[model samples]
Target: RTRMGQNQTSIKKEKLDDLGNKTHFTQKQLKELNKQFRKESPSGTISQDEFNEAMNLMGVVDPFLQNLVFKVFDKSKTGTITFSDFVNGLSIMTKGTQEEKLKFAFEMYDLDESGYISKEEMTKILESFYKLIGPSDDNPLATFSGKKYDAPQQLVDEIFEQMDVSGDGKISLAEYQEGAIKNPDIIQGLKLFSES
Candidate 1:
């Protein structure tokens, strides 16, 4: 039993070293996060249902957005996210640079992973966002010109207009990065998790 415990300690040390190098966190921080993750998911990985529960605890009640966030964390597409992936994603959302945050946001928006965001994809994400936060009376798109258009679609169109600088039908990473940097609303949308 002592030998097993020693081996586990070594394994954890190795993981902490590896994850520390890859993430912008100290060894202590990683250890705490690993402990928290283990408490939430004793199996050492988080299933979709477990993820949904965690998101609910964090006040992200929209299942679509929760699933989207889950997919982003499950980088391997293995139907579950390991602690390593979880911490990596958390690092990006919490401590990563602006460019890194924007890239992560771009990945979230690029639902199909086609390296671009289509109007439909953006609209769907916007719809999910509205569902998560509910309709806002102060929404800029609430009643433009005294008309109640589909706010999600209007937001998508506005975003596409700002982001599709090449006049292309889809938004590439470069365009997304550039557009997000220029637009505070885009940046806010990208930082939804952190800001929320």
Candidate 2:
């Protein structure tokens, strides 16, 4: 796949422009990420099926999020991702600035690139999360300043309330970014990025 927005270059140039933008990544992170990437595809390229298996093995159970990730990384939309594409995608996910992270998060949630996240979309995503990590003992709640959740719906409701700045029940791109900036961890929860 062609890169999301990048000039074609060699391995050295890929490392130099690790983020696909102006942001560059550290050699150590690049080396480690590449090592991980190599384990998945010895040919230095990853197809859609292989990418799905890799994320599933990594314990990412959310299918929707996994699809979103594939799209973001597969810039060319050729159903495959090269080493350079992987590195640039990884750098943006892990080391990009907050605005970058917010944009990525918005894209993931936007679904149709409609520039707005409707209640239906939000509900679907939230249900996926609830399925992955509910309030059971295996998945205790940690939101609300460590308060336990009464129900999964409460968490979803709270997010909608805080993020729907227009009171229209739908979150616009601007509203999504503002909410993500206010709660940076929300963007980090995309699972492509590390907590650090």
Candidate 3:
């Protein structure tokens, strides 16, 4: 029985080491993250509804943004997030480089994985954003800034006019990278994921 227990311990350690190799987190960090994930999802997988509840607890209350994030994290398209998926996606959002994060951000907008962001795609994302941060009496821009806010369509047109350098009517990945690097505000505006 002691030998069997030792074998089980070694197997668990091996699994953690494997995940450590795949993610940016250390073994200890992975363990902690897994503990948190399991605490939230005891079945070792999180359904979309559970994910939405967790995001709401994290203060991410925008249903549209929450849905987009869940779609991005559910890479396997199984409509559920496993521990591995959660860790890998969290690693990218928390520890990935600027370009890597931008790539993930681009994926959120690309929608069809077509390697480019069409105007319609951008419009959908921005419309969701506008729903969250749209003009309101509490919005400073609507109050003190005294600046006219562009509608979602106008915003998408302005973004394409600036980022679609190839004039191909689509914003390619390269154009997105360049535009994001040049305008930090663009990255801020595309804040579906928390960079912190």
Best by TM-score: 1
TM-score for candidate 3: 0.82
Q: Model 1 over residues 19-86: C-alpha lDDT tens digits?
A: 99999999999989988888878998999998899899999888888888898899889999999889
Give candidate 2 misplaced runs (Cα > 4 Å).
1-21, 27-44, 136-152, 183-192
The clash number for model 2 is 1
lDDT of each: 0.82, 0.69, 0.79
* Tens-digit lDDT track of model 3 for 1-196: 9999999999989988988998899998999998998887899999999999988887677887787788788989999999888987888888876777788888888888898999999888877766766766543222212334557686677678879999999999899999878766666544446542
Question: On TM-score, who's better, 1 or 2?
Answer: 1
Clashing pairs in 2: 2-76
Q: What's each prediction's clash count?
A: 0, 1, 0
Error of 2 at 55 (Å): 0.9
Per-residue alpha-carbon lDDT of candidate 2 for residues 57-111, written as tens digits (9 for 90 to 100): 7776687868877887877778889877787676677677777777776776677
Model 2 C-alpha lDDT versus the unseen true structure: 0.69
TM-score versus the correct structure, for each prediction: 0.86, 0.70, 0.82
Better of 2 and 3 by lDDT: 3
Model 1 root-mean-square deviation = 3.2
* Global local distance difference test of model 3: 0.79
User: lDDT of candidate 1?
Assistant: 0.82
